[model samples]
Target: MSNGDGSAVRSYHDRTKHSPASVRASRHALDWANQPLAFKIYETLEPIALPRELPPIDVPALEAIARIESSTANECVPDLPTLTQLLYYSAGITRRITHPGGEIYYRAAACTGALYHIDLYLVCGDLPALAAGVYHFGPQDRALRRLRPGDHRRTLIEATGDEAATAAAPVILVCASTYWRNAWKYQARAYRHCFWDAGTLLANLLAVAAARTVPARVVAGFVDRAVERLLDLDPGREAAIALVPLGHTRDRPGPAPDAPPLGLRTVPLSAHEVDYPAICAAHLASSLETPEQVRAWHGQTPRPVAPAPTGPLTPLTPLLGATAPRDAIDRVILRRGSTREFGRVPIGLAAFATTLERATRGVPADFLDPPGASLNDLYLIVNAVDGLRAGAYVFHRERAALELLQEGDFRRDAGYLGLGQDIPADASADVFLLADLAPVLARYGDRGYRAAALEAGIIGGKLYLAAYAHRLGASGLTFFDDDVTSFFSPHAREKSVLFLVALGMSARRAQVVPSA
Candidate 1:
């Protein structure tokens, strides 16, 4: 039951690694008839419709993705319309394609298998055109369904162990994932997708918030059970993943109302539910049980052991501050989609370098001490990037350069490492985030697993936006975890692979807007 026991998380990660023999030996199949519902339906709760006509966030997408911290220092309480805009661009349905079987609803962010398992909820004090309450965002209807009535920000403040942003903010957005919705395709591994999918969505959220100059901070360390009780989430199915407090405020919350169960009924996700004990067990293994634990867990960023590179180095030319592409963030997010097939073409070294530099700048999270530290290291498989040799390399984030690990055509190796997928082979580059979890788990315990995975997801999400900012394409892919570490060995020795992203020109542009 101790969250500090990291072996539980390690065991789960080892069991889920996909190998050539393991993939071929698998017997998993999708059940189209029993597919889980995309939206969490509360049939009894009346929908409070959000504004339809939302304003465009005109900040250039590149600039927005480059900066993780909100620009504003002054107190800024967002109006209802601002909230609507935030929600729309973050998780709203952007477009849909009608098919003979059904319509495929495309969202603002990319998700593995297009499962749309991640959900958003808002907890706020009374604001213009909105009442004080806890509300679940129903993306299907573009509405908020009230779950608790009254100011509940104090509950989150306590849940986060009095995180500075949570204590000062007037509103908090809770990100949660319903396992079966994604588990239907990924099975037990869907637990990892919980953070991966949510991280992509958060990239959009943080960008939109920055575009509007709203103060926001990502609080990942929290008393898990308290927040679950406050939100009334079913421990077996849906669980809160991260908390983002938006728009600073001077006034403190007086107190919180009781969070007794309302026993609200929800429409079943599918015709039948199959339990995945591994998912629940892994979650429980890393969960924080008390505010004291959460308090002790925050602000302890581990210094991952990495020696100075012995290989050749290539300095990155990232577009410095204020000189970036002007594609509006809202537009970029709307146009974003997971590129399926790479064009097998070369992209500018600058474009690829910008993604690495900007995405790894730093994330504004409670788990990151001094605000700029990170738990993951960036390793790359370069296949077709212009002005960069075709080879494998490791990113020297501090020096803003790449250290060549090996020089050769790695397309064949990339394909094999990415679970034998063609995307990584054809893409201009593939980024694999590796973390030495011995130090991470030692510093933060099993909860360090959550920190590492969440940070990987957030950076992968940023990489997605950074690629799209330059009109390139990007997609997150699963990899042979141990193989990835082996490929970047010596430097990446003893490190665990947290996430992988493929970047390049799409073979053909994905349909951002469906044709009539």
Candidate 2:
């Protein structure tokens, strides 16, 4: 198998070395205005109206992926209420705040600059209330707009090279991101935001599924053109990032009839658009044109092997205990948001350990650190954890213990690493995910770039769930790429920081009680 050493990957890797080019000269600024819309709308197809009144079933809060207790692939056939709940929890509006400009709505997950680029689409066979068709999830209205009417999972089956789970699934969810939405703020790096935002959202969706007993698996490998065409998307502006096959069904996929080209229009998100050439270039470079390419892309490789312990493995006996009583996702999400302000309080070391252990048990994925291992490393700045000295530590998953690296009051340093954010200094601990990119990129190519970010974001998402389950607070943050690894020194020299999450007790408690 050829490594993702293609010119596309090489160009991307080279671009990373060069200093930031002038924004004036960047194609992202000029070319974006003329680029085609991300999705191809079908004017002929009527919109499939989704259920407004969603299910009232309260979903249990799942703290850890390993602690997920469902084995059955059977789902509840998602009535209007269940579907509404899924949509709301997955990408629905949780909060709206008024500002000088106007009002800004925040979703269930954290996004870069709050510039939401990721969009959700649902394709399913005829179910109890809904029909067999492809529909677009509109978080704006909390409804689904029908794109095409029929069982469209077959296109996914073909795109995924007939992956068994996708082929047998009842409903498949597709996640796509429009570049300009996030690129306006992040510039070329909007490409990275695509996966990061998607992973954070998927974290919610997956947890919701676990709570609802829906078996879902994320499929990153697929024929790019097929999916792009099925969604009527222009390859240059937007593309499919990931696919989730929801609910196991013995019923096989029906034959995929030809989907004709669609030319529909959508309201422009913003007046002016900015294009990132490097993002477009890298995306095109890593794109798989044929199903054969997708098949050959995933060559069998030996899973990662953990090295023998070099020193004493700290046993985390105090952390293990029964998880919090199942809290509903609706309540958790309503209470969830990025912590802009944090109060310096000492959280119990047991609570910290439990949160880490529960969150990192393992995310169900084909490309993972190992069967039970993860792709990213968890490093933390212990500002204040009861019974644990304030310092920097590396979480040893195998031993379920945090190995002390440097012991000191590094609140100031923690803030600096988190791009000089106040929350890091105020929080009890800052969790950073570090990874050896060379191996991951080698095994999975440029696509591995997506995997690493997604894995970190998913874990970060779980961290949010874990914190909220214990009535704590958490927030996703960004950091200086090289500085994070530098702060952790010799131990994390080769590793690069993928994502950051700050966890602790909230400074202010909400007075209003959540509805039952």
Candidate 3:
């Protein structure tokens, strides 16, 4: 596959697909001794202490997740405290667990294997109690370490071809990923996790921004080299995945001063690291080289509308007029964790419908045209839901209904599709997010894969929050890609599974100490 061509991403996806035979044939084993550290540490930089005692936004979790658009008013700039709260609720370390091995720092968002490979950086103009500069978010210490001084939002604006959101934004959050941190466990597939993890983080960011009335939008179209250079990131190791413009401003900053090389030091991830060339190749293949290319990639091609449902379509009972969950976004995120075991108890149909309705409302992203359009379709295997029959169904986001695909218990089938995990088999519902890759790849080239997977991850993240807000449990799981498509064939014959999230009642309470 040619570099910068969409082929590289397509090749990687086809190569990394999970199958029953592939799983059985593989002899991969975890190397506990060589496990990478969950947090990225910068050695020389002094931490810029952020406010730990943040006042929580009062927006209900359900209402927050359902917000589709960001505030457009220019006066809605986020001050230091608001920015601090946004970062904390989005990617900050929320819980600490002590074990014989030592401490495990779990973050605000759900990550694959709890391996927090994704890192956050801040670029902004001066704000109340904060200076204009480039800074890295150290979730371990809950502080920001300045990497460079002076405003640098213009660099991002240029990289994004003067994207409207980035141009008017007072602060921009850059999401990057360190390959080896997650690759230690997932290997080449860790490439996909880069966007998946970022998507999950953005899920929190967008929701929190909405709750706080801060303008925010995910910017995926940007010159790859430009962003990496601005962040001083090694493209081969840590690369920028997405840029999110936070808050709003009528004034645009002047041209950025030349960004010189900064040879900053970072603590080693582990005693040793493994390199996966496939991951790097896939990234390079989908990367946009020029600002013009970035501009062209801004909008997504319109998806073909689905035909009317011929089967029995059950209208969704969304919690629109019903009272929303009282738990605020921060409290919900602090309590959220991947369910280790499901109770197999049936969740009320209203709760299930609320989760689906709220999560799929849509995301404000660059790849999605018209802002709120989604790139993936949602399919579900209903194991147990009060008032819902045990069967398979595809969600109609537009119509707000479920089109019955098959009527039968798919407990075993769900388990098999989820790489033989009991989580899906035992959960109340397993949402399989699938996309037709052909059109996606054709439209955005190889990068569309990232957009599709990222969209699924964002929605999956929302599902996690919605489930937890209602005092239920939710976990994101991997699946046998082809099998998932096969299980939902006819309706999803051409689509490929991008992400899976299982939701249900928890079997036991998780033990986690709140972060100080």
Candidate 4:
């Protein structure tokens, strides 16, 4: 709830942590009849239907994004077709499956509940093939609906205190979460989901932008009220979470139009939605009130180190080189979907090794441990990895091999750890990321929550990329907090699980191909 006001909030370590009984106790057994939806619909503005025609892009362009090769902001500008391709590949529904229950649609990224709540809004200057305007990306239809017809990039620049990326971007992408979409299943935890879910989606968006040779950067600090008004969203329900400045333009943007409120209407997503108090409370706490406040939160000093590695250190040896003849990130994304059914089989140790090597090769971020260091530790329950013994092990970044802690099949344990999800139990291995949080919270305060979640997502995103590269399957998973810490305890005693990813062979091929 604390958006980022330098509040000395207690980390998850300091909380009067919930016991199994306490977790259930804190869980408000919602009365289904009384469930309240999360989005606050304004009865005025008409629903603007999006365009249905989205052209296809080449795989090489997509690969450029995943590899961050498209990050150079020079003279390149995104045309209308490129914009459409980015949005469609980032969050559009790629596959629809008919089940006994009904039809279930899968999106571009793997979200916790598959509760697609995050929305994309575009602000830009006039460009070739498209008029200059503020627009909303409709994932369902793979199109853009014009909201305000003019350049509004200057408003964002002012909101971000003229952050270099925001100031120079030709078009900016805004991500907002409608609380109810996820809260329907997760309730209060939806607040955390807002970032986690959004982060995963951004992972795809960022990579896609890179593929298009469009330079983009994530901006988390901005004047909250100013952005909320510019998009005319109800901060209580649908609030902006992050921004991405897409491509570059030589011409400086002029002043933004006075953001007069336009109350928009939309169809209800579900029958009902339940509100979570803790989530909303946490969101409010971190919100920035002014541009000055946002400016103050921009930079962070490098973390001080204590000691060097003492454990067996092994450097990663990925199967494919950075320039391997792999499918482009765009092609991989169009084909990616979370594995709902994993086959119980031993994944080649080399395959597992390659994934770790490629995914952990550091992401571009200012808040990381250092240039090559990461804040979290990768621990695993090796249910099955060919040529590797079944065991509990810690991945030493310096040493690419598993430092075995204990050996045995913990398939059932893995199932329980994943909050009873069958995916982890059946997967060859489940990679659990744990971090020492005392220093993290002390350094960044409540904002550390954002860092931990974001870092986990970037790596998880890389895992998705790496797994696909290896002809394997992977899915981001959720778990019982304490149970996970306890599973990797003694060694992981002081550490906490930040994120989980299950990797193995999938039982069925459900990859989607976007309509041309």
Which candidate order results from sorting by TM-score in descending order? 1, 3, 2, 4
Query: Using alpha carbons, what is the TM-score of model 2?
Result: 0.88
Q: Rate the local accuracy (lDDT) of all candidates.
A: 0.88, 0.73, 0.88, 0.71
RMSD of 3: 3.3
For model 1, residues 179-241, the per-residue Cα lDDT tens digits are: 999999999999989988888888888888888888878888898888888888999887899
Off by over 4 Å in 2: 1-3, 6-49, 56-59, 63-69, 72-77, 97-101, 299-314, 317-325, 369-371, 509-516
RMSD of 2: 4.5
Query: Cα RMSD for candidate 1?
Result: 2.9
TM-score of each: 0.97, 0.88, 0.97, 0.86
Task: Let me know the TM-score candidate 3 reaches against the reference structure.
Answer: 0.97
Displacement of the residue 402 alpha carbon in candidate 3, Å: 0.4
Model 1 worst lDDT run, 10 consecutive residues: 507-516
The alpha-carbon deviation from the true structure for residue 497 of candidate 2, after best TM-score superposition, in angstroms, is 1.3
Q: Write the per-residue lDDT of candidate 3 for residues 1-516, one digit (tens) a residue.
A: 222446778789989999988888888899998888888898999999999899968888899988987658557679988988888988998878899978878789999999999999999998888889999999888899998889899999989999999999999999999999999999999998998889889999989999998888888889888889888998779889899998888888987878898988888888998899999888888888888888888875558788789778889887764565678888999999999898767888888999999999889888888756888999999998888889999999999899899999999999899999999998989999998888888888888888898888999999999999988899999999888998998899989888999998887632231111
lDDT of 1 at 333: 90
Q: lDDT at 202 for candidate 3?
A: 91
What's the candidate order when arranged by decreasing lDDT?
A: 1, 3, 2, 4
